[model samples]
Target: MDYGPWSLVVDAGLIGGLLLVGTLIRRWVGPAQRLMLPASVIAGFLGLLLGPRALGILPFADQLGTYASVLIAVVFACLGLGEDPHARTFGRSTAAFSAYSFAMYALQVGVGMVLAYALFVPVFGTPDGFGLLLFAGWAGGFGSAAAIGSVLGDAGWAGASSLAFTSATVGMLAGIVGGIAIANWGARRGHTDRLGRFEELPATLRTGLVPPGDREPTGIATTSASSIEPLGLQVCLVAVITVAGYGASEGIGLLFPSFSAPVFVLAFLAGLLVKGLARRTPAWQYCDQRTLKSISGVSTDVLIVCGIASITPSLVADYWVPLTLLFVTALALNLAMFRWIAPALMHGAWFEKSLFTWGWATGAVATSVALLRMVDPDLDSHTLEEFGLAYLPVAPLETASVAVTPLIVLTGLGWTIAVGWTAAGLVALVLPFVLGWTRTRRRPPDDRVEAAP
Candidate 1:
């Protein structure tokens, strides 16, 4: 298990190097997008190449679990900054639509668990059936799986670490394929936005590029003002927010045995909350757009680097059965969902409808951004807004399921099976109706929400 200097690549968070290579490659090619998914794949595969069980060049692969834990927290902080909890502006049907979306997506996790348990437990003969079930959940959740897996290990569930890495890799691959498919299909159907949609015309008053006599400014004041905080201060503010979120989440995990806080979600909420509170305060006004952007990119880049370091190649070889089973199951479930359930549930509002499917299927913020960006680059602000709204309410559910899985196993094997079956059944049978309910003008009451997946 001794690691050599070659392990430095994995140790020094070399994902930046990988990204540089990717950027160079993309530059050589045309103006192709979908960089995140490809970057994720490359990083994951690179881990496999240098991993202990494979080429044995990077025996330090075991450290990836630790990196994933912190990376997840950072990811959550980014999410919080991008979202606004106070808005609660998802319109009348958001709850129902979200409920239905989870239901439909649960089959991917449930069926995969059942099938994997049947195939692997009998062959490998491990007693951690519940751990395997939790693994399936992580796979369905994708990017969060590694973080949740580490949280599981910290809670004394060792099997979860392996399960998390395997599942996360599979989920990333699935998202890439699904995103490309959806983009191609949508484009063929004349649904994708043209480049012109993103082309920004200069405003006479705002940019001075438009003719001066073209139009007169309305006497109304602009809704927002520019904040001029120093870049260093802004960096410190972001750091404080992320640390607060991580500490708060880790503290909460101590209170509940199976409750692992998804740090990314907490950080995201904390950022948004802090920003909202600072609205009237001049101090917060100092935190300007440039500051926020710099903080976000730094955090996101760190997360990606940590994520790449945490993935072990050994899992790819050692847990091939469970990993492959989960991958195939998620793909099959997503296909069924997009083809049958989504169309049935939400007939119109193509943008929201597509977003719902893509977000659930991918379960990664980066993946979701890629999906929306593929549709329209000019739509970054609007898409991020909608996604922020749709994702936050669902954040609790995602975190709860991951955090609670270990506890469910501690109770009894029957409980784990029950949860798995319930989740799978909801996706296969109950999701469509919820979608249909939300698609209508009438809002369905929360009391009518479907059973937990």
Candidate 2:
């Protein structure tokens, strides 16, 4: 169906209604609370049920995927703005974690591509681009899916967005459900003392409600109401950064039409520049981290719902066989990384750090945080802190993968890149042992970083 500008409002209203219903169901339903499912996920499934692909009860815009694609840039802009430009101190533990993380990205990309060429393409006739769907969803979540999907789709890969979104939803499900199982396993095997049962979780956590004593403000006012709303100020700052990124992306496209970079990355670079420029200004003092996070939170939630709902079931049905094989293989390898590789190399708090990387490797950092809370509820493991230091280089590697994966794969050198990444992953895995950089300082999680998706 043809849609105009007003379609956005209609879509937003429908999403809002679904969100309300999703929240209510979570509050009343026992299983949902136990699963710790996000309201966005619930709402997205509802949308899928009611949307055109299924029941067609509620009308939605044709550009649901586009909404998700654009919102990701907004999310990244907040991330870029939150960067701490100061030099960081890294220790062996941090180095070990970094190496582990590097391996995660490399192997996921490498093995995925290797499987695509060696197994799927020969047997199922899947395209060369099939390899990218794994990391796009598993490692980066919906944001990475949107970023990578757009690139592949533009490169003439039909239905890439739907496949990417499906991969992400499935990956997230694995992360949450599988994570809970793994956490429980850890608890049973004497890895942690905090977890008794998911049922025994505090009501506030299960119900997503904050009691009066535990209530904390989302953010403090960064600007006076008289001058401008604090949130408005933040929105304005992010908007400027976004516009700057758009300009950069557009200029780059004009100069080199063959190369199209995602606006999110450019916006992220713009955010870093903005953050650095503002560092010395008096206005910088008023830039609260929490405020930016609140903005990011809103956009991230909306995109998750839109991304899932936008998936085309038919596209998924067509690719189910290969996707199933691919995901199963990836999960088995992930288990090895979690249960074996991480423990052997990591020093103090090996279980905690490995668990953190396991969660992140399968999904994103939020998943890592949830698992960590169950294992090291007291935040003593310093896994997050160490990851933060390691993030300095880790973040770039991930970003580069998303941007360059398609370029390399499209050039018909998919297998070569696969071998190279595999070798890189293997080398990273071995370096920790050879260099003896397994020990690390157990520091506190840094507030300067925002693990926003």
Candidate 3:
């Protein structure tokens, strides 16, 4: 048999092997455990170093980039499937959190574009729309980076994907390390009520694994494994939805030949439709949220590893100066916003809530949870609870921005539209404070805090 069709199997095996190595490194290396970096991230770097870009030792490296793109779409589809938009009501906290989150996005993109036009365009002759990589990488992480990068690439911005992925790697590291530093600083300033001790964290958490006793069942079996495994069913559901999204996207493309939407966006809509349909019938009982989350988690890990491994060294070398300037400037702005603006916007538990936002703005949601755990070990601050309520409204806007921003850039409205967005975000950021909507009251005793999604 020709090895052509089986090449992806080799890529998957390489990723899996590297992940195992990353796990072992985290387990045995004292510094790695202390840093608490995700194993997938570590594995990605390892793959990059050993792959064709560096040592030319890994045959599957070239194929991993394509895998990252597909996995990102799967991750988005699962996200839509598992999300419950109607579960939470809009309130002051919701408005505040949503506004604050959107503001961060705007500020990051706005500042990034201004700098890119002034420095990158003049110095390196980079594309005017290249500045959006800041938002794509820092706020959007690997998934957004891939989606936006692909869009930008198709729009004639060569090497956008590699540069965006590099930015995401830096942003992820910043979110983890910077968040820990901020949490420690908050503890020192008496902003944190519960300052957790490093020694008190379980070895499993530090090493990124759950002990046997700590491993709770993520989902109940809907059917006997002998008859039909739950995980396999869940995977099948995701595949069906993704295929539906592809067909829909193709149909749309036929009508609007000038515009093309990312598959992830369509996949998310498809997932929402599937989820809504399931809820109206007995099928919902078989669709476990936890199982869906697990699928997303797996997709994310694979995506991150592949995305990092796929970075082209020449691209990084070409854009090193601009990438450095963008990263440093974005990091500074995010830190400033968290330290000053976030406190004024959030009420009651400002430190904890702001810290969570800081983590997420820099990396992904997982970083937010990690930082939140530091300041509110028992999760008593209700930051997650309130954030959940806020996220229902925020997520759509976030997704829309990810989807539309590239299109806007493609249409040559890069800086002009970015400025308008920045203005809108500023309004959202400050309007709440002006209207006296900044204060958060304590939740009632009977208020039930939902688990983090």
Note the Cα lDDT for every prediction shown: 0.53, 0.80, 0.80
User: Cα lDDT of model 1 overall?
Assistant: 0.53
Tens digit of lDDT per residue, candidate 1, span 296-379? Answer: 555444445445445545544677665566566666766676655544354234443454356546556556655565566546
Model 1: pairs clashing at backbone N, Cα or C within 3 Å: 64-310, 76-264, 76-265, 76-268, 77-267, 77-268, 80-268, 80-269, 103-427, 229-286
The TM-score of candidate 2 is 0.90
Clashes of each: 10, 2, 0
Candidate 1 minimal-lDDT segment of 10 residues: 444-453
Give stretches of model 2 more than 4 Å off. Answer: 85-88, 199-204, 438-453
lDDT of 3 by residue, 209-255 (tens): 88888888876678789988988888899999888877887898899
Ranking by lDDT: 2, 3, 1
Error of 3 at 344 (Å): 2.0
lDDT of 2 by residue, 1-453 (tens): 578768988999999898888888778888877767778889989998899888999898878778876888898899899946455887777788888888988898889999999888899998898988888889877778887887788778868888988888888888878888888777676655556455555556577666688888988897789999988888998988888888998899999998776788888889988888889798788888888998888888888888888888988999899999889977888888877776656667777777788777776677777777777766786888888777677777787788678778887988886898889899999998899874433322211111211
Ranked candidates (TM-score, high to low)? 3, 2, 1
User: Clash pairs of candidate 3?
Assistant: none
Cα-lDDT of candidate 2: 0.80
